[model samples]
Target: MGDVIRTVKVKLDVRRERCDDLHQTKDQFLHCANTTAEWAWRHPDEYCVTSKQKAETALYDRLRDETELTANLVQKGIRRAIEATKSGVARLKNGETTSQPHFDAWSVVYDKRSATFHRDHVSLSTVNGRIECPYVLPDDPEQTPIGEYLLNEDYEFRMSTLQYDRSSGEFYLHARMRRAEREEHEQSTTAFSDAEHRTVLGVDLNVDGSLAVTSTGAFIGNADEMNHRRREFEKTRGSMQQTGTRSAHLSIQSMDDREHRWMQNELHRASNQILEEARDHECTHIAFENLTDIRDRMPGVKRFHAWAFRRLYEYVEYKAEMLGIEIEQVSPAYTSQRCSKCGFTHEENGRSKHQFACQKCEYELNADYNASKNIARKLLKRLHSGQTSSSGGAPCQCALTSGTLNLNGEFIASVDSTAEGESTDKPTTSVVGN
Candidate 1:
């Protein structure tokens, strides 16, 4: 395992009189970052800059002349702007629809030179000067123990962000801390370094039916229940809108809030379920389909359902990282139609919404389950071949609790894919363009 970095979020107890200073600082930082981003976007040559030296050489002086930010804060803003611009440019190059980077959030970055850490309070730089703001730890035990890690000597503080929540009228410091990797975690991760030894959990997400299905034959989340709840919300909202009364509009607002909270809770539970499945199976990695251009791929899916897939992946990603399990995304190109049994490639293979029957090999299984097996195979293929291989190659294998699937996708007793020799040549199964 490598060194671990964690972000600690705790409220900042700031007096009313000092709030304006922070507001001004955040506004200036936003202006600086956006201005720098706009300039970089206009000139891609400048935005391709990655190193701190290049960023300083290109944006440092210009940002300083435009804003009242200090040298350290100005540098931080320039670096942040560079990152945003690079990400946007990369996404655009990848053929993903994206707009120019924009910074509109109420946030300010502080480095060691600009901020000081104390037991009870943090000294932060603002437009006025350095201000000592006490930390407000969460009262609930279930919440993150802010003091447990922040005050520990083993963790070293890094650059952090100061943010304000307009609705709560509270300021927060997202402090980044790092510590060396633990010996036990290193031992566990050493096993992951071996491609053939690693156990992977393949997850398939859907808009209808079950939300997520694993290669291990575990299904999670009820899309029907979620759709029913959403329909009820829509029905209630429509009725309130027809009433056209002030109280009805207020009720509609409350209903929207309630629905959002419920959706978040559902997604969190689904993510937790996925983590449990991976851990139960002793998987080193969890594989998912690449969600880029998901809307185009799933043209019939609603916007909310598409958003749910992305949100669920994000939730699982952070939670999985804590357990030293890695998340991997495989190509979504032929995962559905390609047969996990004989590496057959045909459109009709995934015959229906729920069933997958390969045309060449006559292999049949649940459609999502088959796709999930393909997802796991894609990752395993990449690990063994050092690249993502064509879907028509020798079929990759998967491990189950009682048995493992062979190249033909039969349930025979085995351990890992290495137990059998895989063919380097393509399969005889008829194929179509991917």
Candidate 2:
């Protein structure tokens, strides 16, 4: 069977007015909670049985009577609230638990503080005969520019963003656009065309500041820089907690925002670099570990784990697609402890902060690099062997080349191809240290 190829691009545009209005809407929804609570208290017996629609209608009526909100706006707000309740219920049934069930959705009603509607070209669908609702673009326009470019020209491009310096009144896009053509023979399908063959590169990322590249037999990069920044952030946070002063709190908040922006930029750069390198190696398919489950492994630190894993995977997947590469995910079982050199399983191999020394085969290497090799090998083996393992160990048998050389006096040249057929050829001679 051949693969399906589709292109999607995203662009983001943030208007200052929209951002401020969104924030105000959020604040108003928070204030409305007291209204809901007071009503629930007065009619405790009816609260549970009252449908969300009925509750919202009654609340709107009371707000209208008090001149807190206009009748038309109140009705619009109620309808939005009802939709939110339905969404919350659906999410709960799907096993997602949250302390703030209906919080965020409630704010959508107030999203447009200053509503504008276009008559000639209707921008939004009329809701209950009211045209002053927040507009959902025909398609998500924020990211549509890139999608249009990719689809229209059948080429890949890089897309990135930069925030405005509000104090300085400076706006910067900082977009690094690189367009590339896929130099492969195209095959026609029933509905569309397909590439002759595709390459899948599996990536394994770790919070310990290392990224595993399955296709290259190399650790792409580590998060040491990020870790350093995080440590600084934590120190500042702790110092602020100790101070307990208003000025200290303000400083801490500023620091937090700055650190967050820095971290986001760094992550974006790292993810882009990874994909760019993969493209250079002619990778057409990109794969990653199923991070949703890997996140569950951190029971107490689930929130942090979820944030890190999701951000990395999301960036990689979207960026890969923008580069005309397909992305997939596989199980993340023992990609680290299993040996890529030999099919030796080291179930009892105790790892330190940096090294993964396999007890069974006495193989030693940087833990993240070893894991990456294992991930690439296992995925390729799965594609070729068509075998499933109940034990959940990463499959061995990646066509990898590795050797240790004495750098004292000899000259050597070598070429090694990974499981995905990515070749690295280098010739070198070494001199002893002076």
- Give the TM-scores of the predictions, in the order they appear: 0.52, 0.45
lDDT string for model 2 (75-114, tens) is 4444444554555455655888622224433232311211
Q: Give the lowest summed-lDDT range of ten residues in model 2.
A: 425-434
Encode model 1's per-residue lDDT on 192-260: one tens digit a residue.
Answer: 343335566788888878888876667788877888899999998998899999999999999987887
> Which whole-number lDDT from 0 to 100 does residue 300 have in model 2?
34
Off by over 4 Å in 1: 1-196, 387-434
| Colliding residue pairs in candidate 2 | 9-147, 10-143, 11-142, 11-143, 199-285, 209-223
Top-lDDT candidate index: 1
Model 2 local distance difference test score: 0.46
> What are the Cα lDDT values of the candidates?
0.73, 0.46
